[model samples]
Structure formats: C-alpha cells, structure tokens
Target: MNQKIKRTATKSVTGVLLSIIIFSFSGVHLPVLDSTADSYFKESITKAGVSYGVCRIINATVSVIKESSLEVEPAGIGLSLAIGQIVDPINDMVERLSNVLVMSITSLGVQELVYEISVTLVPSIMAVVLLLLSLLVWLENDRLVKVQNVLINILIIASIARFCLPISSIANQFLQEHFFEDKIVKANAELARGTVDLGQLNDVQLPKYDGIIGTIENGTSYLKQKTIDFKKAIEITIENNGLIIETLLRLTFLYLGIFIIQVLVLPLLIFWFMIKIVNILFTSAALTAV
Candidate 1:
C-alpha cells in the first residue's frame, strides 16, 4: 500500500511537469509536433493518394465499360432485332448495371474523406485531449485512480493517433510492393492502351456527300459504319473487364487493410501496450510490498 502510494505520487509529479511544459508551449502549438510525428504529413499525403488512385482506376474501368457498351450497341443491332423482345430486358439490365457501378464509385470518395479527416484533425484533437488529461492527473483529483486510468487510456489513444498514419502507410507500401504493384501497374497500362485505341477509333474521317439527298444517304451510312466501328472498339473494352475486376479487388483489399490498421489494429496495439505498462506497475508494487 505504501509503495502504491509512492508510485501514484510519482505519477502525479510527472503529470504536473508535463502539464507545465504543455502550457508553456501553448495548447495550439501542442498538436504541431503530432501533426508531423513520424513523417506523418508525408505519409498522410501518400495514404490520401490511395483513394485518389482507386478513383482513377474505377474511372478507367467505367470508361472501358462505356466504350464497350456503345460499340456493341450498333453492331449488336442485328442480334438485338433477331432477339426482339429479349433485347429490351437485356438493355434494361445493362443500364441498371451501369448505374450501380457508377454508384459504387462514390465509395472512393468516402475513402478520401475518411483518410483526410483522420490524418488531419484527429491527431490534433487527441493531442489536446492528452494535454487536458495531464492537467487532470497533475491536480491529483479526489478520484486519483480513475483520473490516472483515464489519462493512461488517453495516452494510448494519443499515441496511436500520432503514429497510425505513418505505420499504416508503410504497411500499404509494403503490400503494394510485395503483392499488388505489378498487377496494378499492368491494369493501369491496359486502361491507357484502351484509351489510346479509343482515340484512334475516333480518328477515322468520314467522306463528304455531294447533294442533299446524297448527304442524307451518306449520313445514314456513316452512322451505321460508326456504330459498327464503335462495336469493335467496345470489344476491347469488354475484354479489359477481367483486368478491371482484378484491380478493383486488389484496391478494395488495400482499402480494407488501411481501415483495419487505422481503426482497429493500431488502437488494439496501443491498448496492449498500456495493459503491459499497468501490469508492470502492479507487479513492481506487489514486489515492493513483499
């Protein structure tokens, strides 16, 4: 009991010293250190890129899908006409799929929002919380044990908030390097190739028609031929879908990994560390008592 009291007294003194230092620096400046903690600013920016990268990937995938559908629309007309009633349902289903895909793209925006807020504001908030907790601990409040426990918990949270961005970013880089880099690069290259091919398809010039009647006839011919060409262009787009799916799956995994690291894994790690510290203090106190 005497040793426990001494330990508590030591903690109170340490907390008082920290509170003084924090106050000396001013609370506003307190977070600046944490903001840049462990190359956090750079890593945070890099992490932000993941969401942007995913958005770009999804956009490319959508473009390929659009081109494919457009190209197939005209050339597939004969097939559509032959199928008659079946065409309407197929077209409707395709339209619905397109809509759903576009909607899913919004998830990329959600990732951006989440990463930005976490890296930018959360650490600073936690730093301020740490400073406030220090003040409470220093005062050696009536409920000293409760206040110390809360302070320790806040410290764990603050520490995680300080380091999670950089750690998760490193993990992200490792995953990309070891597992997904080549596949993602190839997928990007494929999208670039498809874009180039689309541009080339659009480059073919139409012939001029002489009279109004001739112009009308030529115009109708032009539309049909363009549709057929579009259909051909779209074939490549459809073929790229497999690659797109693979890239999306990989990107989704990266996103989930990032989320788990920041939201769950890091906090648990901090909690584990705090528990170990508490256990060590308790053990020391027990040994001192004996």
Candidate 2:
C-alpha cells in the first residue's frame, strides 16, 4: 500500500515536471514572435512621419520660389540670384527622398499584418490554451487543477497583452532621445538664427544713383529692375523659412499620431482583449463547477 502510494505520487510529480517544461518553452516563444512581428510597425511610423514633414517643407519652398514676384534693395540681388539658382535641384532631391521613404514604409505591410494577427487573437488564444492544458495534465487534484488553470490563464493573458514586446517601447525611447538631441535641437537653433536675420532685412541699403546717373537714368532703370528681382527673392526666402516652421509642426503631429497608436491605442486594445479572455475563462470554469 505504501509502494502504491509512492508510485502515484511519483507519477504526479513527473506529470507536473513535464507540464512546466512545456509551459516554459511555449511561453518564451510567444513574446519573441510578437516582438519580431511588431517591429516593422514601429520602424515605419518613425520613418514615414519624419520624412513626410521634410518633404512638405521642400515642396513649400519650391512652390514659393516659383510663384514669387517682388522688388527689393539692389544690394540684395546677388543673394536672391544664388537662392534661385540652387533651390530647384534641392527641391527635386528632397521630393525623391520623400517618395522613397513613403514607399519603403508602405511596402512593409505592417498595419495589414498587425490587423490580421490581432483580429485572430492568435498569440493570446494560444497562451490560454497552453495554460489550461498544462494544468489539467499535471495536477492530480481536480479542484486544485481548476484553480491553477484559471490563475495561469489570466496571468498568461495579462503578460502577453501588457508586457510582450517591451523592445518596442525601448526603441521608441531611443528614437526620441537621439532624434531630438541630434537633429531637432540643432535644426531649431539654426531656424531661430535664420528667423532673426531675416527679420533684420531692413538694414540693407538700396543703391542711390547720384546726379548725372540719376538724371540720365539709362542703367537706373536696369538697377530698378534688378531691385525688383531682389525683392522677389527676399519674399521667396521668407516663404521658405515659413515652410520650414510648418514642416516642423507637421512632424510634431506625425510623432504624436505614432505615439498614440503604438503606446496608447495598441496596448489598450490588447489589454481589453485580454480582460475579455479572462472573463470568459472564469465564466466557463464557474459553469463547469456547477
């Protein structure tokens, strides 16, 4: 009778060990798969937002330059001429880069993949099943098994929904820290300087043709025409600067959208689904007891 009892206890211990091994192996893989699958969503959001804002700025500058017509002080003509010469090609480069960044993000199919996997609730469902099956196999006491199963199911669901893919959060933090420090901060300082300098355009003195030249007015008319070109150039430059500010604003909004989706909306939806799963498991267990 003692030997018989020992054998039964040994069988239960073996079953429990087997269940733990299986649970550990399965549990480990779910988080890995989730992180791998969701990485593209994070990457695409960052790239698309930053690139889109840059492109908008370039496009606005090009449009302003093309449409502008005004007169300014004769001394400003050289500055205007230089800007006119360089802006078109720069615009083209920016436009091409923007198109490439956009296409690259779109081609990744992040939203579609995430949507499909989420709709199926594949990972969370698999976790629940694994927990229940493991408990049922390992536990000798029926009442203890039911309680363990419920606890394990809830725990697994919570872990998958809330704690899976902490790498996503880490990556986001890295992006914000590095991008702001290296790119945005310096760009903002330069923009401020440019803004101040542009605002001081009143300091430029127009050429005042003296007596003989003023009376003859041969090249005076030409100088006056050149002054008109200078004004248009100044207008275009100011417009371009405004576009830069607009671009920064747009980029900010894009970042905000990305933050909402990844940090808030996505996680909340996942958590809600997990709660639903827990409730269902509890209800089923209660009915089984009845």
Q: List TM-score per model, in order.
A: 0.49, 0.41
Report the Cα RMSD per candidate: 7.8, 12.6
Backbone collision count in every prediction?
Answer: 2, 3
**After superposition, candidate 2 runs with Cα above 4 Å error:** 1-38, 45-154, 162-222, 238-251
Highest lDDT scorer:
2
Give, for candidate 1, the lowest lDDT window spanning 10 residues.
Answer: 82-91
Candidate with maximal TM-score: 1
Model 1 residue pairs with clashes:
71-230, 71-231
Clashing pairs in 2: 71-228, 71-231, 72-231
Kindly list the per-residue Cα lDDT of model 1 for residues 4-108, writing each as its tens digit.
677756765675666555445432323433333334334434543544454454455444444544454443444323222322332343344334334333433
Candidate 2 lDDT by residue in tens digits, 1-290: 69866765676566556545544444343455545545645555665655666456556645555433123324345664555554555466556556554654564354435444543454455445554554454446878777866756655664454443343444444555565334544544454454444333334334543567574665768667756755664665656556555544544554454456555565567557657776888799899999
TM-score of model 1 vs. true structure: 0.49
Give me candidate 2's TM-score against the actual structure.
Answer: 0.41
For all candidates in order, the CA lDDT equals 0.49, 0.52
